[model samples]
Target: MVRYSVLASGSTGNAILIQTDTTSILVDAGLSGKQIEKAMHEIGVSADCLDGIVITHEHQDHVKGAGILSRRYKIPVFCNQKTWDGMEHIVGEIKTGYQEIFCTGDRMEIGNLALESFAISHDAKDPVGYCVFAGNTKISVATDMGYVNAKMKQRIIDSDALIIEANHDVEMLRIGPYPWHLKQRILSDHGHLSNETAAEILTEVITANTQCVHLAHLSAENNMPVLAHMTVKTILEQEQFKVGQEFDLEITYPDKPTKLRSVRRR
Candidate 1:
């Protein structure tokens, strides 16, 4: 069986736990080590047991705690070479043997999990998402993308579970307190995905194997969990899709870890 938990998500920090009986991994370690450890322990996961910390990009909110975790646990950190170059200064210093680099689109064999990287549109050095295969279960974690492209849709489809970014509500973002420049950045093609776009992506990519979908990387100031959920729900309904009957939809929060979502192997 394979299971996942959103330890934390938002602009403040982002981390997710993907685990099977034999392996345990975190997609990003954006939070401080203390915060991540507490969250993991609250959810009954031991930080010391983590096999690797896999990074999606070099953004501070995605790599803040990576160096601390790696240095403390002596766990391997896997990411693209460009990401290593961009995040090296922020993460400070990592143990020589623990820094692992792989090409953006290659299959990374880490313990019992096979992680395949796929490109995404984001304002970072070579951002990518990952599809993890654990036995018969496939779970894809793709966030921080501005828009869904043909390649992204291809990689996201036919998954057992998924974590897609629903970063902001357009109206709130437009009228919010952010400056014009920041607003423009968030709305750019290389910015985060809005609720509507996320729904549209789901409508195209969801398949028979998709059992659970997690809405992640939400904006605290520009979006609310209920609003994000309703927005996606409304769009999905318009497409004649039943939200609860067809599949389970969940929201990831900035303040706490989500309940463990386990994928039942068929």
Candidate 2:
């Protein structure tokens, strides 16, 4: 079985800790180096235990502390060439050996897990989501997506666990304090997913095999924890799906880490 935690999830910063019996991977280090390390320590896992740091894109909220964590721990950083090129300047210098570049849709083995990167619609050079395979169990992490297309949908189906973005409430964002141009960017195809869209996608992809779902990357200004959770819960229940009984539903934080979560194998 695989265990995971959303170290922090929101527009502010994002990170996730993925662990198996033998391998430990930190998905993204959007927070400061000390902050990421502190989050890991709070979860009872030392930063030294991490085998690698996998990046999703070049966005500051996704790679701010990536370079620091890698430099401090001598851990390898995995990202596509395009993403690496975009983030190189921001992350500062990293040794060539510690830079592991892979293609957008390529699958690579890291320690005790097989991780596959899939393209996502986001406002970045080459943003992607991750699918991690631990033995027969699968854990998928997908956030910062604009909208889910057919290919993206196919990539996320039939997972034991899922961490997906439920960014903002459409109405809230539309009427909120953000400027018109900013709202337009968020509502565009290359923007972010609203709570309803995230619910619709989750409802479509959730199979009987899926054990849990974590709603991530929420907009603190336009989204509330209760609203995001209830929106998805209501939609799923409307489809005759039992929210908690069938599979656990969770919310991630922008400032703090979520509790460790794992799926029970069938």
Candidate 3:
């Protein structure tokens, strides 16, 4: 069985914990070190037990606590070369041996899990999402993306569970309090994914084998959890798919941790 939890998700911060019986991995550590430790403890895991940390990009909301976690726990941090270059100064000092680099499309092993990073359309330099394979189950983490392209769809297809972005609602963002430029940046091709777009992408990639969908990276100012859930649920239902029967849908919170979700081979 593979256990997954979104320790925190939103524009404010992002972190995900993926674990197997023998291995534990953290996808991003955007929250403070103390906050990350508390979230991990809530899920019955310790920060010291983490095997490694895989970073997606150089953005502050994703890399804020990465350095502290790496230094404190003596865990390896894996990221693309570009990401390493872009975030080295911001993340502060990481021990030489702990700073590891993996190519975007290549696979790397950490304990019992095989991790593959795939390119994502985001504003940061060489941003990517991760797909983790454990036994027969595959879990994909694909947040901080503007849109899902063919490659991204291929990467997410047949996943047992997914943690994908449902960042904002188009109408709400358009009429909200953010300045015009910020709104436009968020609506750009290299910006965050909207709730409707995420729903559309899920329709294309969701399969019978897929067991769970986690709507993540929500915007507090522009999106409500209920609205994001309803948007995706309504779309799936319109296509004659039963939500609870076909698969489970969950919304991750920005301020707290979500219950651990497990995917096991049938």
Candidate 4:
């Protein structure tokens, strides 16, 4: 079995602690080492117990503190060659040469777990999301996506747990205070997923074994927790899916750290 928790999830920073029977991996260390340590401590895990750090992209919100955390903890950083090239200047060189490079379709073994990276519709050089397997359970982390493609949909199907993006509400963003260019970037094909778009995709991929739905990367100014949750809940309900029973839904935060989530296995 595998145990996991979202130490924090949002635009400010993001990090998830994934632990199997023998291995522990931190996915995206956007926060400082001290902040990550505090979050880990709250979840009853120590920083020294971490085995690796998996990066999704080279964006500042996803890799801001990646270098500091990897250096301080002496943990390996896994990402694609293009992603590495884009982030090398930001994260500097990995001292131990543990910077494992992998492509979108490549699969790697980390302790008892198997991880596969898949391409996502994002503006980065080689932005990708992850699907990890521990024992018989599968967990997918796919935030920062502009839209869901056919390949992405296939990758997320049958996932035991999913952490997808519900970045903004279209109405809220259209009338929000952001500049025109920023708004354009956000609504572009390479931008984040809107609430309606995420729900539509979930209807196509969600299964009976899908135990949890973690809504991540919400826009602080353009989105509200109540609206995001209500929009998703209503859509699922319309499809005859019951919340907290058939599936669980949650909205992740932007400013404060969230509790470590548990990934239940079948």
Candidate 5:
């Protein structure tokens, strides 16, 4: 059994908590140390209960509070070499005693959890997503990526639970107030995922083993929870996949945290 919680998910910040019987890993720490502590307590997890913090990229929303939390709790911080370079300033500015860096694609064991990293298409230097296994169940998270490549799709296909990005709606983005260049940047290969793209990916890749699908990293100005959910739900139905009754679909907010989701593999 494994438990997963979305502390926060969006451009403002992002963090995920994955725990098994013997391991507790924090996927990212975008929130401040105090906010992270509060969210952890809401999910019935204490700071001391965490084994390590694995960062996805060097983006401010993902790395802002990581070093602070690591120094405060003395928890190990794992990230790729390039990410370390990008974050050296922010993380190094703070005095941290606990830090262990690893290259992308390396697998590491933290207590009972086995974590593997896969490259992702994002604007940041050396951005990657993660797949974690505990016993027979798998929990995968891939957000802040532009599009789902073949490799990303394959890695997430067999997971029991998936946290994927649905960043914006095409129409909203085109008409929104963001500058033309910024909009173009967001639509590029190394940008964020659109709602339609996310729907297509989920409809094509989700299987029976997938118990839940969380729509993450939504753009507040360009997307609404109702829109993202409806887009994916409609696509899944068109593909002859049952919605709600067969599997659960959740939407995470930038300001609000998601309920702690538990997975049981029989």
Candidate 6:
């Protein structure tokens, strides 16, 4: 069985743990090493048990603890060449042989898990999302994307579960306290995805075999969990899809673990 958990997600920090019977991997280590260790322990996994750390980009919320984790545990860190260049200094010193670079669209095996990285439209250099396969199950992690394009749709189509960004409500963001430039950036084509946009994308990608959706990367100031959940649910309902009956919807927390799930292929 393939099990995963969103250890933390949002502007402050982000991390995800994916595991099978024999292998465990961390998708990102945004939090401090101590925080990541405690979170892993809460889920009954040891920090030392992690096999590798795969990074999405150089953004602080995504790479803050990656180098430390890898160095401390003597585990490999995987990313594209561009990401390594952008994040190397911030992640501090990683020993030789601990850096593994894989290009976007390339599928690589780490233990029993097969992972594919695809480009995402974001401000960070070489930002991407991941599709992980274990046995018959597939889980897609697509956050920090400005908008969902056709290529992204195809990449995540029919996934057993998906963790996608629902960063903010457009109106809230527009009227919120953030300065004009920052607001404009977030609303731009290469910035974070709004809740409405994420809902629209879900309508196209979600299917009978898709079991769960986790709304991630919510902005504490511009989005509330209830608002994000209802917005997506409303869109699905308008599409004639029953919320709980058709699939489960959840929201990831910024400060703690949201949910632990085991996704099985249909």
* Candidate 4: clashing pairs of residues: 5-261, 146-191
Instruction: Tell me the TM-score of each prediction against the true structure.
Output: 0.98, 0.98, 0.98, 0.96, 0.96, 0.98
lDDT of 6 by residue, 93-118 (tens): 88999999998889999999999999
lDDT of 2: 0.91
lDDT of 4 at 111: 92
Per-residue CA lDDT of model 1 for 98-184, tens digit only, reads: 999999999988899999999999999899999999877899999998888898999989888989999999999999999999999
In candidate 2, which residue ranges exceed 4 Å CA deviation?
none
Q: Write the per-residue lDDT of candidate 3 for residues 25-57, one digit (tens) a residue.
A: 999999989999999999898999899999999
lDDT tens per residue, model 2, 1-266? 78888999887899999998799998988999999988988888899988999999999999999998899889999999999999999899988799999999999999989999999988999999999998878899989888999888898898899999999999999999999999999999889999999999998899999999999999988999999999999999998889999899999998888887766456
Positional deviation of residue 98's Cα in model 1 after best superposition, in angstroms:
0.5
Better of 1 and 5 by TM-score: 1
Q: Which stretches of candidate 6 lie over 4 Å from their true place?
A: none
- Cα shift from native, residue 141, model 2 (Å): 1.0
Pairs that clash in candidate 3: none
User: Model 6 scores what on Cα lDDT?
Assistant: 0.92
Candidate 4 regions with alpha-carbon error over 4 angstroms: none
Report the Cα lDDT for candidate 5: 0.87
The TM-score obtained by model 4 is 0.96
The residue pairs that clash in candidate 2, if any, are: none
